[model samples]
Target: MRKHAGEVGRYIVNGLVATAVHYSVLMANLELLDFQSAGVANFVAALFGIMVSYFGSRYFVFKNTVESIISQASKFGILYGLIAILHGFVLFVWADWYAFSYSTGFLIATVLQVSLSYLGNKFLVFKK
Candidate 1:
């Protein structure tokens, strides 16, 4: 339990950094780059976030350096890919169907992603 608490702390730190990267890419694509579609932009940003997430979780959160990088990366990719799809879907529904602010959709999707990511990383991707 104590060790897991430490891991949770590390995970939150890594998650904050990764979320910064994600939102930066998202805002850049939406505001600076002038991406026509928020959903597409979000998808691209999420890909970047996924990369940051994998590296951060591997080295900082879980601290599992003994495992094969290839094996871990493959599993990480799969898990995050599913997450990205769901993230995009939620945003798509909000922006496209309801014509709501993409920002709100982004928040909702982010909350879901954060929850799923911690659980998935702990139980599946970085499981011992």
Candidate 2:
């Protein structure tokens, strides 16, 4: 129970960091590069997010005593990269095609992705 609570808390904090990274990347692309396409922005933001989440999750969230940070991070990256791709797809499809607000689409996708990420990270990435 305690461990689960800690994991949840860590996930939330790490998510905030990832969100910051995402937003920063998006803003940079739009403001500096004039890339106004939401899909392209989403992809770039996801890459930044993955970088932040990899280190944050490995050291701060999961704290796995693994062989090397690179190995553990790569495994973690693979897991969340799958989730991020799904998130990007959903964001693009619903936001662009259905005319849903980007915020709304992102909210729905984050809820789904976060649930999957929690289980996968707890059981697979940092498992004993």
Backbone clashes, candidate 2: 0
Which numbered prediction scores highest in TM-score against the true structure? Answer: 1
For residue 37, model 2's alpha carbon misses the true position, in angstroms, by 2.5
For model 2, the stretches where C-alpha displacement exceeds 4 angstroms are none
TM-score for candidate 2? 0.85
lDDT per residue as tens, model 1, 8-127: 999888888888898899899989999988889899999999999899999999998778999999999999999999999999899878889999999999999999999998898898
Residue 36, candidate 1: how far off, in angstroms?
1.2
Put down candidate 2 lDDT per residue, 10-117, tens digits, no spaces.
Answer: 889998888778767866875798775666777788888878877787788888766587777777889988988898888889777787777677778878877887
User: lDDT, candidate 2, residue 37?
Assistant: 65
TM-scores for all candidates: the values are 0.95, 0.85
